[model samples]
Target: MTVPAAIQSTFDDLGTPLADVTFVVLDLETTGGSATECQITEVGAVKVRGGQQLGEFQTLVNPGEPIPAFISVLTGITNPMVATAPHIGSVMPAFLEFIGDAVLVAHNARFDITFLKVNCERLQLPWPGNVVLDTVHLARQLVTRDEAPNHKLSSLARVFSTRVTPDHRALHDAQATVDVLHGLIERVGNLGVHTLEELRSYTSRITPDQRRKRFLADSLPSAPGVYVFKDEHGEPLYIGTSIDIKRRVRNYFTASEQRTRMAEMVRLATSVTPIVCHTTLEAQVRELRLIAEHKPRYNRRSRHPERAMWLKLTAEVFPRLSIVRTVRDDGATYAGPFTSRSVAEQAVAAVHEVVPLRQCTGRLSSKGTGSACVLAEMGRCGAPCDGRQSPDDYAEIARRVARALDGDGHQVIDALGDRLRALAADQRFEDAAVVRDRMLALVRAAARAQRLTPLATSPEIIAAARTPAGGWEFTCVRYGRFAGATVCPPRSDPRGFIAALRESAEHVERPEAPVPAATHEETEKILRWMEQPGVRIVDIDGVWVCPVGGAAGAQESLDDTMTDRGDAVDFDDSTISRRRPGLRAI
Candidate 1:
């Protein structure tokens, strides 16, 4: 199936029956394995149709190179024999003409075809776009080692009682392959493998039970929806959502899928239940919910949403940011469920530089005996630990920090820019670069927090992503969770379906805060989906806040300055936790 670029084929329909097509079984004798270094010494082929021989083509080509000694002895084709023969350039055009749009067959076809393809390139000839089939794969499909002892042409020639025996010479080997191909065709024909495509994709690995399970998907709803596979005990095995529920389930039973675990899961599944969806968006949301709810054994990803870590700003008399592994119902502002603790810390450090929030690990009261730390001594903090800063004074700084977290990051970014300019003017580019990195991290974190905040709090957001195949994939989200997903094919009026999705969106029960980490994850997914080019916001039931001027323009300018290719800031160099939004009303 891996046709060389040198011999790119026009599409060959699999529907072409074996009896209706002509096959040219080819073989080549080469001086070496690689066509670039090696040269073809001989070429041979036998043409046939419907198990009857049509003609034979054989030619010895002057390789313009010495044949390897062992190969010369093996094939009995030496330089002496090829010296007076026509060169490959003269021979190939005739060979191609003989084959013409006929289907090509060979044992380990890549080996023979590579020599031909390379020689054609060397001669500047247009390689024929021939449909190729490998007898090796076909033989393996029908002839097991136990039956043939080995799949080599010599071994298979004896097994099939082939008229011509392989002797390593091109013509004899090609003749043996013709017989072998007919034998395989006959054996596969009994299994209803008549079309070329059936012969191409057919696999013996499918279990009988898997084929019987076809009945499970026979009555599945054709609509976009989530499907769950459950065992006889009614425990969920796996969960997935698809645009066509029936077609997706049917794939699991096909040999075309080579996943061993999928095969095992399909075997254990006693029933498939479909949850018909109004939109592609709802299907996506429901898949996430069901996966989280059931934590199916075979399901991976988002099964343990709580494992995500986030940086939080404590709701206290004197608020300070800290990293938390979970979100909370208590009044607090949150920044991220960052992929790792390391990433979270980088975001935190970026925030501290602008706000001068206390970096001390524990709680300290103004009247308490807590001493100021090194950060305060370095003027990094307002020294709130020793009451050098009053509650009112600290509150003002915290509010600035809160504003930065809520996406009004201009203040901190402007401060960092001023410092960065100063550093650069002083010829301290390394220092300026450090400042630039911190500014970049803060920008990314702030944008992420701002983008997620609305989706996390909104009652509903209906959005659409334009597909490359034409059409829009619509999704409904509620409280930062996936409510549903549906697709709108090209030129189709989506008003009626959009109304239906709105109605279904009502039944999606939103989880109470502390919101599940999965909600934040889903919000991230939808944000990315919406960012796709040609995507549009169809409608919303709540405010979906975004930066007014958009962060992309600013981020691009910084990227141009730094030449950093990363789409998001890698704050690993600075152990700052992600931005925490301003606290909800206390």
Candidate 2:
């Protein structure tokens, strides 16, 4: 096929100045033919400079009027589709910034560009003056001579062997247009079109397709984390967070055409980047921080600036506690906005054992004469409602409470451990037991409350497998003893099970240094803890023993009951299996 002179000239002009030129490939899906009457449903564009892709932009605009049925059938834009979309008026400024000084290119350049200009004029915005390129004209000059009589985007895609699934939506069409342009560029190169000037002149006569393609290959990490997607320019195009980063990023790339913005993002994206996190809470925090700092163009939803509150406990004579939104240059202290009131209360409860502060919602009486609240009776409060404790004493306690809430778990653990050891050494075995249980509880609570400090090392990996009878059973060789097992939920995968085990390992408390020999009673208690709901206990042979099904109908064990020494009768595999008919190895 021979190139038209006008098209050749346009490509030549564009190629002549590589340093100062920018091209913006544009596509729009609208209600109908008349620009003045129809509304723009969606817009997709990619910006390029000196043959390198800069960025991509897309948005769904709510046409002021309803989307006609035929138009909906044509573009798949129903009335409900754009219901929540921002109107074109609101999106224009951001769009203009993205399109600044870039030559416009579209399949039928005049149809889309002229309509856009008219819309701009209606809104009193300046009509863009950048040169326009039409891929339709270019395709005619380049593909028609050798291929079929007509050159629709699909046909052109077939000619170039572009892998475009059938879809005529704006972003999909834009992608196909890009493929066609690549084919033309390759042909023009063979035709001795070398300089930037010659390329631009040829591209100008036909619609120039944006060359950028979104390429996201890596599976996003399933953990809650922040992700940054940069364009070909190495500038951050978007910043986002997901409880499952992999699922979310994959959704963006595989979304339907109606998700024009997402489709456009996939088309222009050059790389995928992610940061793995331990929890969704951590992901949310990091996402907010990154969005506030980086101000990526596509992160429009999270950019709202809002004041967040924190509950502060003052270090003063009265130690006034109140909720404050802003942190001052100097202040008493702060805890959290906590994302919710329930979270705040949970934090308060965690510290109540050490602080003995009043947790009642009602105000303390000024007259210092009111019945002690339930919290006071439970020893969780200092009887502040009745003014029993002095302000100084309360303030001191409040300081400790603040420390606990700030995730100073080490301090609490050490203090509790010392107390427990003291009780045990005094031969107050009953009291020692209570103290030990309390210490274990606090450690578990602390592990849940505290975020992993960067300096804290990752835990060693432990393996566990599910038992056939319905629960998981395994032994941790590192622990030396049989740790109880847990039933795997039907919905959970092996990865999820492993992640849960890792988290459990973090909170798993080891017995005080020299492991004490298990007394009969202590062993019983351990077995009971294992039998609790959601626990599974597995022996070294990977045999699962469930408390729900008591040992019965035994075949091998001569002694089938608890012995006088408080140990169960010894049994071999056959006897054990016969006792628990349904028992199975994991």
Candidate 3:
């Protein structure tokens, strides 16, 4: 191919680096559309130096599979034509050698790059280190033709009045791309965009690494979760969480303009880590727990203990629920360590409707001689003070009230439904109707609060894998729209995947339970109970204890001075350490 006079003079006038620089314009003809399924049938490159063609390289690659009929028609490359051709495995080394130390220029760069990358990955070849310049992106920036409809190679050829022969052939396409690049350099030069770096900036290929890093960073989870970064020291430098952990962490790493901060962090860091949770509810709980434990220097937000409001219920005989402001501590029967008083009140109200417990000011007398309180008059309370209800009956009611307060909606629904059915069977229609309404309301509320997803049903635990560009890409079925995405990581390791799976399963298995009111002594006992198998720490006998394990082991463990209330005995660091190693650090 010969350089036209007008284009040659324009290239010379532009004084761009291309004339003196070694450039390899390349193209590929593949057997099919999908990069994963298809194989490249032809590889071609045209080497240009000092605005003159130095040499051209072209080879037919045996695709190792049958070329699809449609592909054959599109590129005029038959299976038989490539039958005796050199395979990619045999041709790649020479190709790499020829294009050594030269900028790679291509049309629709990603398409060519995808095929190239796939080929390199398959052959276990390290992709050559060369700057990529996309002529398509360059033309888009240089050409100001508003009516040009498309920027296809054919359209670009027409715009530049350049001859494009043997359209789809690899060498022909490479030559065409070279002409397009020359035209863009001329046009951009006219606009005073003459520098090589300046021209390179117009196309995305100039900063592939930066773009890849930014892209992967953006795809990270924008939800409240944990993130960890480890240094070459093999020690963790940062352990933090965010309402949007992925975004927060990505912001730290991808702040390109803030080179000092990012460079320092990246230099100190060798690996990125993340732990995704099912809900923001769990995220907040986990974040607080991790921050208090790890004390990572970068975690400024969650380092401090959060102040929480609690409902203590102080006035009743069985147990009085009092509304109080406090940090999470081991003392009293606390309903919440709620983020806000309003939220605590809302939870209390929800519990109250299902389990009719007294919310009154009057105290219960030992003689049981007090007059009926206002709540008793309204039938909202069982008047235990006046002996209208037995202690055992009131105790049972308190248990129901406690369960409602615990926010175990599934249990509440079943219990309420049974009660409603019993009332209806007894011909108490009005009472049944009220109970039925309450049951329905609770069901609706639970449904709304639940995290229901198809992925949730899978036996395998799911973690939002971070992409190389820093974003979370996952399958989402929204209404009727379904999207399946391939989220590329900056790097991949089998061991990392295995470790992530194990961690995810552990998290899903051990979701945080809502903490209840308990004295310091009771909390210690509860902690002890949790160490036992199949023994969960729950609120029991107006205290937080392992209801199952405590009852089973309490008699055996208790000394003569220690009461059932868990108040007299104190637990030592050794005991706490044995129960929870993580807690011992705190």
Candidate achieving the largest lDDT: 1
Would you list the rank order by TM-score, best first?
1, 3, 2
Worst 10 residues of 1 by lDDT: 577-586
Best by TM-score: 1
By descending lDDT, how would the candidates be arranged?
1, 3, 2
Superposed on all Cα atoms, model 1 deviates from the true structure by an RMSD in Å of 8.6
Per-residue CA lDDT of model 1 for 1-586, tens digit only, reads 9975784322231146778889999999888888799888889999999888999999998988888899988999988999998988899999999999898999999899888888889889988879888988888888987888878889889888999889998999999999989899888777666667556666778766776676788678777889999999999999999998987887776667798888899999999999998656567767877887899988877787666666687877678988887677777776655666666676687777666888777877866357878987788988877878888888888877776666565776677778878999999999776666667765655566666666776777777766656876777777776666667788898887678778875455555443532455566766665555555667777675566643333454665665454544445322222222322110
User: Candidate 3 on 489-575: residue-level lDDT in tens?
Assistant: 555543454344344332222112233222222222323322344322111111221233211122233222234545433311112
Clashes of each: 21, 24, 31
Assess candidate 1 and give its lDDT.
0.75
Segments in model 3 whose C-alpha atoms lie over 4 Å from true places: 1-25, 34-39, 46-56, 62-89, 99-105, 113-147, 156-166, 178-308, 315-332, 340-356, 360-380, 385-387, 390-586
In order, what lDDT does every prediction score? Answer: 0.75, 0.54, 0.55
- Please give, for residues 387-470, the per-residue lDDT of candidate 2 as tens digits: 787666676676665555344444544555566568778988787555544433333222211221110111121334445444
RMSD of 2: 23.9
lDDT of 3: 0.55
